[model samples]
Target: MDKQTMLSDEELVKNFIAGNVTCIDVLIDRHKAKVFSYIMMCVKQQELAEDIFQEAFIRVIKTLKKGRYSDSGKFSSWVMRIAHNLIIDHYRKQKNQVMVSNDNYEFDLFNSARFSDKSVEEKLVHDQILSEVGMLVKMLPDNQREVVEMRHYKGLSFKEIAEETNVSINTALGRMRYALMNLRRMMEERNLSLTLS
Candidate 1:
């Protein structure tokens, strides 16, 4: 349990891939509220949302365990996309005339901005993963890490990053690319899961 406590989101995912079902619980416990709220926005019924939430995660598990997981985008985004699609499938199957404006649901469902009260345990676990990810960021090369911090933490654009770093826009972009590459590689080496905030 101590060892598991140190694992990152990608690491937990690796555990899930390695056949530890409990890892899935870690994932659900982390994202359940955000995902559930996203579902409720669509279905507007707690029971239906819960059902789709389970179905979405089941599909996530199958995709990961079956060696079909691909890195098309952020992991949280991918899972939310899966859940969104299932919601669509559900409504289609029932032939229900659902008319909900999707403007609110266009972004990642697990967006940290959508906040609710959290339990003490969830808060601690979130802080732990966030802290570890912070350490990983510090582990990056000077050039790459600088860009990552500027972009993610400062919410700067490529131009802004370049301006702040006194580099050309292309250089800024390149640094970001390399930073992401190295970050992904580092997480893979440590078997870290990219935790959602």
Candidate 2:
């Protein structure tokens, strides 16, 4: 488990399957940062991101123990798949309400060099678009909102989300349907059209 000893992903997987708990720790050390950052970027909430990070690794460990993964070099990809699923579950549980946690986040989705050179009027227009989108999300019904957030923010596949949320994949799809519809209605109410052409 020494940091100086770099192990290949396949080696780590083999050691982990052989009951070397230290291998799991080493794997976490190697991938935790990237996975955490990736989830954070998607979720935009620190507490939820942390929970999903822990859940992702826990699932990975369980899967390794189960000996279910069928290939190599795909360890990172598999872990990402777990992370995505957990995020969906997290939001599904929080659909109707907000979660209280100590983690805080500051994300600037609109701050970029592309915006830096824009005129003040253009910046205002960009800000308005972001504001409208935020408002639309806030107005979605509890269940629909959850589905949309999980799919868009967490990057979960419908099947993975269905597993995590304990719903049929069709149900997950229905919730997403309602979510988009409600968001569109809300936008239209505010004289903003968000239709995709």
Candidate 3:
């Protein structure tokens, strides 16, 4: 087995709990880059991926501080679970991303795979469609706009958003629902069916 596999996770946790915060640093150093890489795959933005990476660790520390997690299996799983949820939340919010100009559209701007697969004509047409949808999203109400921006751009959850905005999670969820409904109506009006995912 490798070095990490050789050390029992309990041993590491015990070290971390016994006032060796640097032991947790070792864990962070090992996992942070990989976790960010995974986030980038889903969120498709370097800055947003970095933000989510930091948030994931902050949540991890909170869980540890709460003394809620015992098994290392649960710890690792929990981290990935948080990352997964953040990515999903990001898509939901970005569904109606805004467009300030053609250059500000969100389509395949970050898709590395598309560059290799798409021709210039295809890319240009794709950018046009993205710009149109982004314009539609920009026309949504202010509260819905902010919620979507936080969800998509900042990768914050409904609960995290509620905490940030000093509102209830239900309010956050309601805003998201209305935002999606409005975006759908806008798309239908233009005969465009954009897939949020």
Best by lDDT: 1
Q: Write candidate 3's Cα lDDT for 34-87 as tens digits.
A: 677678767787788888878888877777767776674655667888888878
Best by TM-score: 2
How many clashes in each candidate? 8, 0, 0
Whose TM-score is higher: candidate 1's or candidate 2's? 2
Model 1, range 11-103, lDDT digits (tens) per residue?
Answer: 788788888878877777777767877887788776788799999988998899898987556678888999999988997978666434447
lDDT digits (tens) for residues 1-197 of candidate 2: 56424887778888879887788887788888679878898788778788889888877888889998667557788888889888788788787575334345365544566545667776777777777787788777777777777787666678988887889999999999888777777766768854322
Error of 1 at 107 (Å): 44
Q: Which residue pairs show backbone clashes in model 1?
A: 8-193, 9-193, 10-192, 10-193, 10-194, 11-191, 11-192, 11-193
- Cα deviation at 83, candidate 2, in Å, is 0.3
The better-scoring model by lDDT among 2 and 3 is: 2
Candidate 2, position 139, lDDT = 76
Candidate 3 segments exceeding 4 Å error: 1-6, 72-74, 96-197
